[model samples]
Target: MIDNLIQGVFNGVSTGAVLLLAALGLAIVFGLMGVINMAHGELMMFGAYTTFVVQNIFKSLGEPWSDFYIFAALIAAFIFTAAIGFLLEKGVIRFLYGRPLETLLATWGVSLIMQQFVRSVNWVILAGLLVFSILYFGGVWALQRRPNWDAIKNWAIAVLLPLTLAIAGSMGVFMAQIYKIAVTKPWFGAQNVDVTAPKWLRGGLAIGTLQFPYVRLFIIVLTIACVIGIYLFLEKSPWGLRIRAVMQNRQMSACLGIPTKTVDALTFSIGSGLAGIAGCAVSFLGSVGPNTGQNYIVDTFMVVVVGGVGKLIGSIAAALAIGTTSYLVGSGTFTNIFAGIKPLVDFFTFFATTSMAKVLLFVLIVAFLQYKPAGMFPQKGRSVEL
Candidate 1:
């Protein structure tokens, strides 16, 4: 019983890592700007689509450099989503910043269009892309069970232990409001990842009874690096200061020579990029369908609120909490009993685990809002308001 409980906790923590990936960017966006981007999930879907493209690229080339292609997918997702997010900020989000309701409706419309486009694609190609991709968790599982990386695990714990905790409550995410890029590194040296792979790249590390896969480990490392890099950008840079200034008073920042609009576009792209990466991470775990982001969109919002608005720190905490809690009671019993009653006789009333979890999550978020509208760690200022 104790062993099972311990295992459950480990699983929950792993799942929480996934949630954190999705929620961190949302927090950054909302924290810096007052925009409630309804299209956030759609942005993530774009990333998953990037992974799909990479898979297809490999297949078309006869799987030339498989594992390397996974890396290519990640890079493509960041670039692709960032471009779209920037366009969104410039094209529509710029004008709709202060209008929450209008932004929601407009983005929702965009999401529907994207969904239809995905649905229109060839299903066979889609399956092949999702099934043969290197990021797939099944491949990772095979490597983790082998004997190696246990040494690394022992060392990583000391580092990850404090690192994870520090990230949990680091709600000063408002730092993005004050940050700016000092040395914008152009993407010129990026080598296109080939479609074929090296078997060694797809393995794992063991810790006691715990078995962690290489893909997950890669995800953990990449997420940490991004988080730390962004955090430093927000806290330690002069531009970060400008970003904060603009976030607090856009008019003042502009008066002070800060290009508020540029920051807004860049920030939106950065946040959206994070979502894209998360989408790519998830593609390896299951079917990379067009609707992949749909299942997670609501839950991501719930984390954003539960953790606190504009608070990346709060967002991370909320993501972990929600992921762990939702998976705890098991997706089975929890979903069947907690699912919302659908209007159609055979609809939601019939019961479905994943759907039920979502239903329960929505209800909980509603309750959380009633109690703490500002979330767990709202910003601190007249304009820093949630």
Candidate 2:
């Protein structure tokens, strides 16, 4: 019984670590910018796909290179998803700011589009589109910022627009040919893909009677590092300070030369990047599919809300509480605890089954929210007014 209890707690912490990873980005994004990013899950999908691509690339290189692919995949996933998030903010989210309903609808549409694109479009074409978007948007942004270029802007547009398109098109064709030569068949199609764990991460570590899987341990360690990194960035770094200032008072921050717009873009990108990392971590647990992100979106939002929006410590505490409760209930730990009491045993027995655990957990969350609607740690200042 003691061993079971210890095992349950360990399993619960592992589960909580995954939840924490998935919720971290959502908490930051929603807390900082009152925008409910419906497509946040899709960004995670992108990260998983990025990992898939990296895995294939490394595999093609040789056996030795394949073992270290995860490291490269993590970095690639972050940059890839961060770029997408930045483009998303600049292209669509920027215009929908302060309008929650529209933002939600737009992001939902984007999510659907992304999923379908992955299912229908070839990887080569997706790469081309990504390249095109980056170059085109980058050039336009640069042109827009130029001083007193209005007179020549039209001519510059006429020359630069086609040039950018031509260059991007050429690159796409070049990449496609190279891809065809290197990989005879497409790496990904409509079906899901699996990311195999490295040899080092396989199996479990034994501590007395309890066993801990390396993958779960890695996730826990990674989550701790991310939390610490974010804490340091927000507390000790200038950009993080700017982010907090903007979060506290956007208009005032802008007035004080804080560049609120840049802060928004940066914050969103970081959040998206974190989501990507979450996806990479998730890939180790199961197959990577287009719909993978959807699985965690609801739970992630719950974590953020229960923890109190914008409160990091609150998020951590909430994740652990929710995760542990769910695991304990599902594992019948609660039912066992009530075994000696007839009435309590019957009550827990009914609710402690795997299928019913989620229902019970949800009910508990609802009850908790009824008592503390602002969450365990509500934010003060202009955030409340907004």
TM-score for model 1?
Answer: 0.70
For residues 1-386, could you state the per-residue lDDT of candidate 1 as single tens digits?
34445455555555666677778778777767777777888788778878877777765675456546777888899899998888788768889887888888988888877676565433332333344332333434444576875756555546554554444324223222233232122111122222222365466677777666676666667767777877888889987777768767787778889988888888888888888888887776566665767777877888887888767688768877787666654534333443454353234333335566566667777888899888888768876543
Error of 1 at 219 (Å): 2.7
RMSD of 2: 3.9
Candidate 2 at 208: error in angstroms? 1.8
* Window of ten residues with lowest summed lDDT in model 2: 181-190
Measured against the true structure, the TM-scores of the candidates, in listed sequence, are 0.70, 0.86
Per-residue lDDT over 83-199 for candidate 2, one digit per residue giving the tens place of the 0 to 100 score = 899989988999988888998999999999888777766655667677777787777778888886787788887887788778777876787688774432444657899988888
Candidate 2 whole-model C-alpha lDDT, 0 to 1: 0.85
Count of backbone clashes for each model? 20, 0
Model 1, stretches more than 4 Å misplaced? 59-64, 121-204, 331-352, 384-386
lDDT of each: 0.68, 0.85
